[model samples]
Target: MRKTALYPGTFDPITNGHFDIIERALRLFDEVIIAVAISQDKKPMFSLDERIEMTKEAVKSLSNVTVVGFDNLTVELAKAHNASIIIRGLRAVSDFEYELQLGYLNNSLDDTIETVYLMPKLQNAFVSSSIVRNLLKFNGKTDHILPKEVQKIIGNMTSCTLH
Candidate 1:
């Protein structure tokens, strides 16, 4: 059987930590779908098209990875992609509480689907989209924490553009 996993997130701007999780997920699944969520409540800095483009560019070298956008529940997205597993990245203990709840909720939504948690490299553990956004907002250097393509997008943007 072909094993497929779905990794869904807003990915306002894909970060190195998110990239790290994608790389690691590729090792365990035949195809890992990077689902960029069209979040309704949270307004993202980048448009969905921009997020998808940046994510595609960031993972262009990985043949087994695919980037797509979704505006539905993650479990529904997983089912649509024929994925039996949902991959969530765990950064710290604080992340676990929310992730655990999400895992249970998703599992309840679709009993056959399973949620898997993966941790990025320790160096990337501290990096997150919100942090990167804050860094960019203050003109703090975020090149070290973001992917090249993402860096370029933020590099060209003024603080006013983010809002």
Candidate 2:
């Protein structure tokens, strides 16, 4: 049976660092689903549809990868998609505390669902969706920081408004 992993995140504006994790996850799993979360609480700069489109474009070159939007439990989403593993990205020691808490929570909710953490490349180690959004929001330069397709989408936007 194919081993599918669900990589869940807001992916508000998928960055190169995010791509790094997806590429690495592909090495360990037969399939990797970029599960975009419907995080209404986070009030993302981009709408869910926009985020999904950007994610699809950013990962278009990849095989055995898919993107979808969900507003539910991560484990439930995994079960629905037949994903036995959950993929998370750890960029620094600061990320460990949060990721560890999440792993415990997900484990408590469903121990069968395994969570695996991957680190981004050294250059992308510090890049994150929030940072990317902030950079664009303040009209800061972000050359090569985001995927080309995502950068185009952000550039085409009349305003990368924050809420």
Candidate 3:
């Protein structure tokens, strides 16, 4: 049987750090599904459809990866997708506390589903979607934090909005 993993996130504007995790997960699992979750409490910069499209474009080069959107709990989505593992990216110590809590919650909800953490590559250690979004909001250069394609799209969006 092919090993499948689900990497769930808001991916509001998928960053290079996210790409790092996806690439690593692809190596560890036969298939890695990039699942975008819609959070009710958070106001995302990009809509769900937009996020999905961006994620798809970002991962287009990875043949073993797939992207999808989910409105339900991540554990539930994992079950539905027949995924036995949940892939998460760890950028810093602060992320551990939150991911630890999530792991416990996910295990409680579904014992069969396991959470795995992938550390971002050194170059992308500081790249985060939140940071990229903030930079874009201020007309800051995003080339350092995101792929060129993503930076171009964000630049275009900001330019059109300012016009």
Candidate 4:
């Protein structure tokens, strides 16, 4: 049987860190799905469409990966995609507590689903969606952290819609 994994996140603006995780994920699972969350509470800077498009473009070269927008329970999303594993990226020690809580919660919600944590490359480790947004707000150089495709999409925008 093919092993499929679901990687869910707001992905307000996908960073190199995200690419790192996805590329690494491709190695472990037969197929990987990037679930872009519709986080109403976060009031995202990028629209759901924009986030999905951005993710699609960024991962275009990669095989066995899908980019999708979802607004339901993650486990439900996983089930819909037939994903048995949930992939989470851990960038720092601070992220562990929250991610661990989420792992347990998701396991409680569906004991059949398993959560796996992976870390990005060292250079991309500290990069995150929030940090990318903050840098863009100030016209900061994010070339080191953002994928070229993301920089293009974000550049085309005419205004700042801070979350």
Best by lDDT: 4
What residue runs in model 2 are displaced by over 4 Å at the alpha carbon? Answer: 159-163
Question: Please, what is the TM-score per model?
Answer: 0.95, 0.96, 0.94, 0.96
lDDT rank, highest first?
4, 2, 1, 3
lDDT of 2 by residue, 82-105 (tens): 999999999999999999999999
- Cα lDDT for residue 51, model 4? 92
Candidate 4: segments with Cα more than 4 A from true spot: 159-163
Please list the C-alpha lDDT of all candidates, in the order they appear: 0.90, 0.93, 0.86, 0.94
Alpha-carbon error at 82 in model 4, in Å?
0.4
On TM-score, the leading prediction is 4
Clash number for each model: 0, 0, 0, 0
Clashing pairs in 2: none
lDDT of 4 by residue, 53-136 (tens): 999999999999999999999999999999999999999999999999999999999999999999999999889999988888
Q: Ranking by TM-score, best first?
A: 4, 2, 1, 3
Q: For residues 87-127, could you state the per-residue lDDT of candidate 3 as single tens digits?
A: 98999999999999999999999999999999998898888
Please identify which of the two predictions, 1 or 2, would achieve the higher lDDT against the true structure.
2
User: Every model's Cα RMSD, please?
Assistant: 1.4, 1.2, 1.9, 1.2
Q: How much is the lDDT of residue 53 in candidate 3?
A: 82
Comparing 1 and 4 on TM-score, the stronger one: 4
For model 3, where is the 10-residue window of minimal lDDT?
154-163
Model 1 off-target regions past 4 Å? Answer: 157-160
